[model samples]
Target chain A: MNLNATLLGELIAFVVFVLFCMKYVWPPLNGAIEARQKKIEDGLAASDEAEKELERVRKEAAVELNEAKSQAAEIIEQAKKRAALIVDEETTRGQQEREKIIAQGHSEIDSERNRVKEELRTQVATLAVVGAEKILEREINQDAHSDIVDKLVAEL
Target chain B: MAAEEVTLSSHIQHHLTNAKMCSTDAGLAFNKACADSGFWTWHVDTLAWSIGLGLLFLWIFRSAAKKSTTGVPGKFQCFIEMIVEFVGDNVRDTYHGKSALIAPLALTIFVWVFLMNLMDLIPVDFLPAFAGFVGETAFGMDSHDVYMKIVPTTDINMTAALALGVFFLMIGYSIKMKGIGGFIAELTLHPFSTKNKIGMIFLIPFNLLLETIALVAKPFSLALRLFGNLYAGELIFILIGAVGLMQLPLHFIWAAFHILVIVLQAFVFMMLTIVYLSMASSDNH
Candidate 1:
């Protein structure tokens, strides 16, 4: 081969081949690589986003749980207060009712004792008038003697 | 025309005349004569040898593929695996970021180019002469037209093709990594910039010119590096072949030296590809 021709041919061929390879082969190869890299980056981004969301949700849930717990505690406290109030009211009401019943029972017992004593006094006066009549064994007018005996009984 | 009647000096003259017809500055005349002489040509036989080499590579690798082991690999498999790993590692080291295509592309390039370069190890005249014989007997074609150069990497077309592939990849990766605006900015403002209005005025044109030159130089460098190595190796082989058959020791020595050339050329090609891709992927101007 002539050196010059060979060199020239080589140069020309080289230029053409370089152009062709750049046009056809390199793009897809590089694109495939870039695409894979992009996919990895996207995956990482998505994961990061998900993690952030998870953190936010976790915080929100925790706050909600705490709020719920606090509210529940408040409700329990309120219930306890209400129960104490009810017990206090009920105890006061029960004591007042018991006092009223006991006072009524005492008044009833005093009235019954007064009636029995009055009845005993009346029976004793009648017996005393009868005994005087039996023990004297003397004839007496019913009107005059009765008046005197009544006067004596009144005095006694 | 009678063989016995022709004097030795006259025979020499006749041969000289015939040789003269085959000589030209462009060597087109010689190429044509060689094509017409029914002995040696370039295209058809070179293509056939390329196909044959491709087939040989396929066959060898096919058998080797069957022997591939999961645990302790056989010699051939290990060798192939090592080559794959080496190419992979080179791609990983040179091209930053996640490269799905660059790695495999680099691997294929290494193996394919290496196989192509290995074709030079075959006796230069063997396949061509064999093709010549086949052309004369089986095909009944001119044997001279059957000239074949087996090593494709030695062909400027092949190397240029590889370089061009890299060039396009560089452009693509640059665009993807830098965006259109950024790419333009790199061209217009890189290596110098308008930090001050006075500096900007002076630096703008200069930077643009420099950047333009750099852009042009990129593909040229890639192309020349591959072509230079391959062409020089081809030239050495041709020179060795020209020194007559008696210089067997010298031929062997040259061939041994060419082994390094073959490997180095492939490596350079692969390395340049990675470099170009890396540059493309980089945000830095």
Candidate 2:
């Protein structure tokens, strides 16, 4: 109920406590709060950067896959063209070999026919001479007729 | 019957008195031996408990600050940060002036004042009765002489001291914002004035008188508001205790309601101090 020197003591205590609080307590805690805010902001930014990087890699992979697929298609196309050309060349070479074999066979057959015809002609001539000799021997005595037959054979 | 009435009145008186110490012409004195006009009187109980509570607040905050991290906070750090942020937010909202002192000062007043007011919730007779028993047994002093008022905010001196501190800060801010000349002029000008030189000159005294009362009332209201609320609550607690065994329920109910008053008064004190400083810092005139 009365004013006394206790107020002075309390006043001193209040000022000292406030000064101490301002110096010690407030700054570090505020620093920690601000630091945490910065840390969270940085974390979010890094995550966003990583997400962008992932998207870029995914796009690159898709492009490379398309390139590889097109290259494979081109190789298959070249192989098909080479196989078709080889088949065409083989067919042409086979046609030429068949023609040459046919020509040789025809030439051999012609030669054989000519040799048989010549042999047959020779045999016919010999047979005709013999018959004429038999006739001459029976009809007119043999010597003069034989001479004629030999001459005929020579002519044939 | 008269003797019982006297005893009851004395019980109420005993709860109201502080454990006082003061200087005398011979040497030192306590309580009744101190003079009525003893300006040197010290309320030892109020001083001890209030300062002790203030230190406890500092120690806890310091430890919390030490353990605080930029990462996930533990429960203790979380609770401490909540209170600090609460005061910081209030200061930021109420105080437009850019000074480092306001937030921490607000925190100090709020926590320190709240702690002092919290002492009212302790059973009214518990500490004083223990103090009396100890005094009678340990010291050879009469138990009647042991007056221990534990709730510091209930004492006018303690609240007045806090309010006076805020009052000084207000004046300092007003002076700093509007220099010495501007401060004096501000006190003695406007709120009423005239373009006429003679009329303005006549208005100066009236303005000074009105503004001075307004300025002085800040601290006066601040001190009495907290002291009156706590003192009334304490007196009622004391009165209820006189109801014998039934005091427990009534005491609980009153204390439950008083908790609101205790917290609200501390908040109001802090808010008013910030608002006053903000007003001082701004040169609206």
Candidate 3:
């Protein structure tokens, strides 16, 4: 075959094709590959961040649970102390009340005995005066005997 | 038997010949001065098919590039991507330069040469016969004068053209990367440089002679290697075609073997181009 215009034609065609490919084809393809790679990288980073956040949340929850447990125990201890103090206070008040009631009863009994004794003494004096009057058969000095009776009442 | 043998040899010769078009005093003439290697003579069939296939390659790749995605690729896109990746891999492995042109150049050479070489798989008489019919009907020319050789790589012109393109790139890259002085020094001082100044001076002409021959031989070998393989393969097809009915099975067998040769040759051409360009660009000469 003659090495004529065909060689030149092929050369020109090759050069043009190479230029076209360089200009139009390679960039977008490479861009797509790079973008997919970046997407995968970002996804991996996000997953790592999510995992860290989960760990932080878990630790925070555990700490909060421990604090709540200790506070509950403190509240229970305080409640028990308050209940014991209330019971002790109630016991002392009840003892005081019983003592006061007993004292009042003793005082009332003494007063009653004294009143009975006074009544008995007055009755005896009246009996004695009647017997003496019958024996003497006369009213012997009533004004002078009244003074003795008054003295006897004062002694009783 | 002698007549059959004569016809067989002529048949092979006929298939090997190109459909040449020469501008005559009267205008475009078919197969005029078919043996002549004049400036006006064009290998019509070779140019037509080669350019047609080159355009097809461009159209397919360009369209695929246009419709390409970051998401899942379609079947056509996948196929195009596979080819691009295959060629890009070779370019990456062999080409050391940072130029954006080399990879695409390698890709074009690989695919374009492959498409040209694949023409050999067509039955010997198929396209020529078709062209002959069309020529007779449309152009009012005799079918006998419409000589057409379908495979472009079988033509020395096409292969030499590709190889020469690589040769120019090799020189261009060498000059661009190493500077003119460094390139000259490399050519004149390589493969036989000595520590002794006087002795090295004596070695300059020897080195230049050998290195220049080596430089020219790169393209020469690249062209001849492809041309020889395809020409031989096409000749075999022509021989098989002359066997009439038995040619079918033989065609199948030869086609299978030629497929390997075709792909291998394309790969070799592309790899050599990349290697040559890399060597030109690298500082180690």
Candidate 4:
């Protein structure tokens, strides 16, 4: 077929088509695609940031937990030490109290025994004097009376 | 005429010809088929067909463009939008940097070529035979001279035109993207020689010749590829239809098969256009 007209027609048509499509078709389509791509990239970036945040929080929590655990251990150790010191102090105080009580009891017993012995000796002397006075009145001589008293006292 | 006892070839022509002979226009060779009256007649030529098809597609796309939604698209909108997106994505993948023209140009090439290619799907005899009838009835010209080819891409002129347009675009874009000096430098120094002056001198002439051949070959390849596919398709359809009444079923089957060819050819043309544009736009050898 003679294609001179056809060729010219096709060229004109292609030029018109290229112009028309450039004006109307490409913008929206490319916009939509680029928008979708950007959205995906943003979503991925957000996810990465969230993951990093999560990691940071986990580390912080671990540190806090470790600090809390160490503090509790230290408190427990302090409590144990305090408890041992209190027990030792209480034991020493109890022993001192026991010794003071024993010393006071011994002192009281010694004082009571000394007082009783002194009282018994005084009573014996008084009884002998009374018996000698009664016997000397009956007998009327000084030398005889003295000798009788001494013998009576000795016999008692 | 002396009958020199000629021996007939043993092979017999098939019975299908008898059926076709029955449908032959008895007076077609002798008949002075006329052209039709009215605007439709002028529009019957290749140029008119191209313009008309372009306008029809534009109208359809305009309507689709008007109904384009911000929300979820309807089925038709989605279909149209898919084509648009596909074209855009293809441009992005193939053509790098900011080619404001190439992407849309590629889109136009794709749609126009596709529509032109679709003309092959119309029955071979439908338009021309109808035009012949109309010519005889209306314009009072010979129907034989009406000679309207509906499938524009099948025509060498149409394919070459398209190729030439692309060729011009390639040149224009190259010049616009790469300055005249840069363009010349590239042609001279490319595909060899980075630093050495000797290497540059040796490679420049060879590269220049290769580049020149490549530039010429681009349009040729584009034109021939589309023309070859479409013309072959048109030929096959004509051949199938020539088998006449007995082969109606076979013709129908071949027509169905031809639909695949039509779409495939369109796609191939579109892909090649993208590739060529990409090549033209690039700095790489």
Per DockQ, the best of the predicted structures is 2
Model 1 TM-score on a 0 to 1 scale: 0.53
**Residue B234 lDDT, candidate 1, scale 0-100:** 60
Candidate 1 chain B, run of 10 with poorest lDDT:
B12-21
Best by lDDT: 2
lDDT per residue (tens digit) for residues A17-77 in model 1: 3343334433443444345557778989999999999999999999999999999999999
lDDT of 3 by residue, A21-136 (tens): 77887666555555666888898999999999999999999999999999999999999999999999989988888888888888888888788877777776665556555665
lDDT of each: 0.63, 0.89, 0.83, 0.69
TM-score of the first chain of model 3 = 0.48
Instruction: Compute the DockQ of candidate 3.
Output: 0.38
Query: After superposing the true interface residues, what Cα RMSD does each candidate give?
Result: 9.6, 0.9, 1.8, 5.2
* RMSD to true structure for each model, in Å: 15.2, 7.7, 7.8, 13.1
For candidate 2, the TM-score of chain A alone versus the native chain A is 0.46
**For residues B31-106, what per-residue lDDT tens digits would candidate 2 score against the true structure?**
8987573788999999999999999999999999999999998999889999988998899898876898999899
Candidate with best TM-score: 2
The per-model DockQ list reads 0.02, 0.55, 0.38, 0.20
Candidate 2 scores an iRMS of 0.9
What is candidate 2's lDDT per residue for A111-154, written digit by digit as tens?
99988877876776678766765665577555666566667666
Superior candidate under DockQ, 1 versus 2: 2
Candidate 3, which CAPRI tier? acceptable
